[model samples]
Target: MTTLPASAHWQPALGGDGFVEGIDDIRQAIAIILRTPVGSDPLRPDFGSRVWQYLDWPIDRARPHVVRETVEAIRRWEPRVKVTRVVVALDAEAALKITAYFRLASSGPEISAEVRPK
Candidate 1:
């Protein structure tokens, strides 16, 4: 007997109507959540993280603030993972880097994702 894999959610794929499954679904979902500015969605005024507010500020100061907001937003919105830690840093040439460490709710495997704010 063969068992089929379970799909968590479906999201539109780039340039088409096809959708992605499983871990990719969560990754894309989280990316969209982080990129959207707070209050941009009238129906969900508090849907996004506050990272955009600090995007123009100095990286040293923005790091902690970004981490805090990202962690809080993830905890509130995304139920698929439990955030372990968030590390915000400035990459070479001063681009902001946000790395989040988390554990999958279903399989308990550790994962990390890099996020960029719009």
Candidate 2:
């Protein structure tokens, strides 16, 4: 996986959607990732009850397939245009970096990319 520079960022343009569209996309991506033979296993080592309870509602309601499709679409778009690496800041102090690599096929215009979190 390529290493993203610490300063990279991804800001989606979804005006006034209040994250609804973003969440939907995330759901599709998750679904596709989960369905892939190599990445399909669900995350384990469950969090403690308190933490789990805090996230239970959203986790229970998430649509995996939708998330998967959304991610697939993004990956497909990667090389067609250009995408910056994503950098996420946590706790107002630390940052998580991610990078994507692309591959193209002659038969199709679509590009495939894999984003790896670092």
Candidate 3:
């Protein structure tokens, strides 16, 4: 694992309708990650990761706005990182899932996160 330099602030470009909701969720997720304990037997590193993991695809499919919001939120939260991949499927069901890898400069190692629609 690598450690990235702390960001000065989050910066994201979001579409109009889903912007607020997405930003809020991203903020919440970041807070959760910040609060995670770093130890030998620590809990999940971040609540955002858990939230993403258990997100309901159907709901996101039904409401595409939510997925847009999430993407924007992530972009803003971590502007320095670049998205390595993205997957969107509408045929399976009313749901959306996004998995991303990122590279950061000025750090010990690269950091990445998978953001899923909830």
Candidate 4:
């Protein structure tokens, strides 16, 4: 496998290059997209989800809105995967927990990823 420069975050795999591929790559992309605030990237003003907006909102309202936005953004940006479900939860410390279920575009295998905005 070719070693690729880390795009959003550094993730080292055992006995493998730092390159992200297949399902893992999709997961990483989702994490980066979710964490990035909209308009943060001047080149792509709509490249990110709106999860950051709900960060300070009440949990009851924020949870559903965040989940909807997460699903919409992933579907729009990440065409390599078909999003099946999105779950939003708040931990005791008020941290957002986002879990997304999806299937690869080329293959039908189901996969899940968790994304928490930094």
lDDT, residue 112, model 3: 43
Report lDDT per candidate.
0.80, 0.30, 0.40, 0.82
lDDT of 1 by residue, 7-118 (tens): 7476675445567667777777777778888899999998988889999898888878898889888888889888899888877767777888888876677788887665
Candidate ordering by TM-score (highest first): 1, 4, 3, 2
RMSD value for candidate 3: 13.9
Clashes of each: 0, 11, 7, 0
Candidate 1: stretches off by over 4 Å: 1-6, 14-17
Question: Over 4 Å off in model 3, which ranges?
Answer: 1-67, 88-98, 105-112, 115-118
> Clashes in model 3: which pairs?
2-109, 11-76, 12-76, 57-95, 58-94, 61-94, 61-95
Candidate 3 on 4-46: residue-level lDDT in tens? 3344443332334322223343343433332232232255332
Badly placed stretches (over 4 Å) of model 2 are 1-70, 76-93, 107-118
lDDT of 1 at 73: 85
Q: Report the number of the highest-TM-score candidate.
A: 1
lDDT of 2: 0.30
- Which residue runs of candidate 4 sit more than 4 Å off their true CA positions? 1-17
Residue-level error in angstroms, candidate 3, position 78: 1.4
Indicate the residue-level lDDT of 42 in model 4.
98
Best by lDDT: 4
lDDT of 3: 0.40
Q: Which 10 successive residues of model 4 have the least lDDT summed?
A: 6-15
